[model samples]
Target: MTSTPAFPPLKTYLTIIACALLLGGCSSGDEPASEPPRVALVEPLQPAEPQPEALRLSGVVQSVTTTQLSFEVAGRIERILIDEGTRIRRGQPLAELDRVDYQLQLSEAEARLRQLQADLARKRTLLAEGILAPAAIEALEANTVAARVARDSARRDLERSTLSAPFDGVVARRLVEPNMVVAVGTPVFEMQDNRHIEVSVDLPEIAALSIPLGPELKAEGQLVIADVSLPLRYKEHSTQPREGARTYRLVLQGEPPEDYNLLPGMAMRVSVQRPPRPQASQDQFRLPLSALQADSDGGHYIWQAADGRARRLAVELQEVEGDQALIRGDGLQAQLPIIVAGGSKLHEEQPIKVQERN
Candidate 1:
């Protein structure tokens, strides 16, 4: 029958409608809410004032005078009075070769010289008595001169059989042992003058060129073994670039501390102060390293907050010192807000809420 549809009570109908309305409201609320702008820590750009650029480099301690000692005469080593690392004075005897052969040669030369001298004297007497011709006396005199030269050479050989120090130095190495026969001019010892210590460092060609001429370049050194820093004088530098490198060798000399023995092969740190470049002083800005970012092509960039948004700016990285970076860009200005901490996730023109870094 078309009897009136069975209707729920009015209260029940109201409750069902209320439930539907609540479910609809929940569904509407399911849509995502827009996120607030990302917060970023920022600091004002600082202009890099014109200051001396300090270049620090590792250096090696070297002896100013290093020489290889050799015997002038070949002989068997008979006695080695000093070992490696022995400190010696100039002209101090260091080693001796077997002098027996040298002595015998000297004796033979002396005997021959004596015999020639006697013959020359007898011939001169004969000439005086008119028994020898002038030419014969002249020939005898020439032979006596030759014998004298031979004797002097033999004496020189005997003296050279003993090796003596050429200068005050320390023996760096001893190459021969007792009873070992060595040839003439064979290296027997390596000596170094440790009293005059030199430090050598490699400098880039660019840096070497930037140094001012006529003694304006200043340098100092700190020994790795000691805490003292000493003023260094410019000793010399290589005129050409080092082999296979675009660097020049810079040598500096300094007096060592009395308490410390600054020996060869020791390490040192050298600091060279270069004058500022006029062209770069105005455009350069110093920022924290965190403010820098790299693109896919390895180009560097930084973010600047303007009008409450992050703006990507291209920059050229000049140098880095500790946690700070020196950079240059066309439009960069001092006192501009730069996003330092939260720049990694920022896109170009992204809205940013910046917190000033004190």
Candidate 2:
């Protein structure tokens, strides 16, 4: 005991040593440790080819002249000569109504007219021979004139029972069938002149002011559909904006190309290329719409890949056509990779793992 200097028991010593070791372990664990940052996959931006700066719009093909035809008189439809989409010429018989009643009326009127004419002639002869009073002859003359008018009216009514085309056009709609009873002024056909087609494009007020309109301007236009381009002539522009939109309508007038068939209500891409100003740059590029993002200040920006990192750059969003967005910005190069997807969450110059686009 004296030699050990009255040290604690073996059990107490062991417990103290254990507690010290535990405290040291906890302290070491409290120190911060390093971690590898997550890498986002990225790809090179495929910038679209830079072409002449022009605005491309969407429009619909419509007939320049359309008319709704109706029966002038009420009757039962007896026959329909033309069907929908049938090409018709001016004065073509398109339909007919039951004319039996009209025929009978005309016949009765003619018979009455003959009797009045005979009476009038007899009365005139008697008056010329001084056998009848002039007043009585005048009465007979009035009767004859009234009978002739009645006959002419009956004949005109019979003629109106047959429907005829007023102009050369295509029958766009047939609203009635044979033997269908229709009232007066009931629409029976919808006809359109497709030979002279018009493409109506809606444009913003700012844009409408830039493009010259009217036949004199003849702004170069093309109605593109299914990859087919047809030249168009500038016809007119609306001075008033369309309802529910702050855009005016610009109408392009032209005939379909030779042997190229176009119908009303068909959709087409309309391109109106304005003469490039000397100060305007022809540089423009297209990218997937996803690559574009909006800023809180009403501006748009995109993320481009540079030196294995995401580089954010501001861009001017020109227009959106289909799945692509046309953009114009400074120092934008073709074939430069831009982040198409997962770019909204990325920070500028963030480390990105290059990968092929899925």
Candidate 3:
């Protein structure tokens, strides 16, 4: 009975412990909770400087002199002396036609001319002796002249059977094989003068108008081939736009390096430095497109970090080039820090922790 009197009831002990826990919770709730400040990545605005705009375009390397070679006379191709990519000299024999028929024609023509000449000589002697009529002698003279003309034509045809290179060039294509029949004026080979090369670029109408037009225009661009840059000189430009398009053809000539083989139809790049635009304004800032935000009225704006708070700056988008937009706005300067990231969640006069972009 003495040991039982020293312990308290189980229900009473439970109620006392619950009341002490409630008092501890009420005391801890008196202090307010604190949150970390929101981070904002910022970068300085870049002022757009008035500089020469570089227009990069795709171009193709071509020979300045490209010609399609054909035979002057029709016959079977007896021999093709050059293959594709064979270098040739001026007047070098390139191909030959079957010569057997042409040779026979020349021989027949020569025999006829000889016979007429002998007959004419005999007739002249008879006329001097008064044994032949004057009319007959005249007729014989006419026949002799006709025979001479025939002989010359036959000889010219025989020479034409052999095709020769018109200039120093490399054979680019061979359209005929040996013993293949070809018609007169049929293209037998394609040749190009590789010593002089030109680059062809198709530029839009706006870009074409910017190029200076004069004989003294020099070194306006560079032709890049396999990472090698070569100086380019403006040769010519087409007045009419390219067929079925609004682009004009621009031809630029360049001397290839001694160790480089610049061939026709080779793909390359052309970088043209356009002259600085006259009266172009430079009071704009070039900013990343992502830094721009839209207002409730559909106007564009940007966030500027001022005094550890977000400030709204209204901007007018002047131009968008690639991923960057050129904007002009009030209070937009190169020295101003612009919030590029975490700006969508910012409000007016909101505190921000700035993190400078490296």
Per-residue C-alpha lDDT of model 1 across residues 257-308, encoded as one tens digit per residue: 7777788888999998888766456789999999999988989999999998
How much lDDT does each candidate structure score? 0.88, 0.80, 0.84
Query: Across residues 44-72, which tens digit of lDDT does each residue of candidate 3 receive?
Result: 89987655667788889889888999999
Candidate order, lDDT descending: 1, 3, 2
For each candidate in turn, the TM-score is 0.61, 0.60, 0.59
Lowest lDDT sum, 10 consecutive residues, model 2, at 34-43
Candidate 3 CA-lDDT value: 0.84
The digit string of per-residue lDDT tens for model 2 on 1-358 reads: 3565677889998999999998998988776664333354444544554434466788888898899998888899999998899989999999999999999999999999999998888888888899988888777788889999999999998999999999888999998899899999999999998678888888887777666665544433444555556778887778899999999988887777666667877787877765444423457777888889899999999988777788898999987867788888987877777888887788877777766576
Clashes of each: 0, 3, 0
Off by over 4 Å in 3: 1-55, 220-225, 242-246, 273-358
Candidate 2 — what's its lDDT?
0.80
Task: Quote the positional error of residue 250 for candidate 1 in Å.
Answer: 1.3
- Which residue pairs does candidate 2 place in steric collision? 44-337, 45-337, 45-338
* Candidate No. with top lDDT: 1
C-alpha displacement of 198 in model 1, angstroms?
1.8
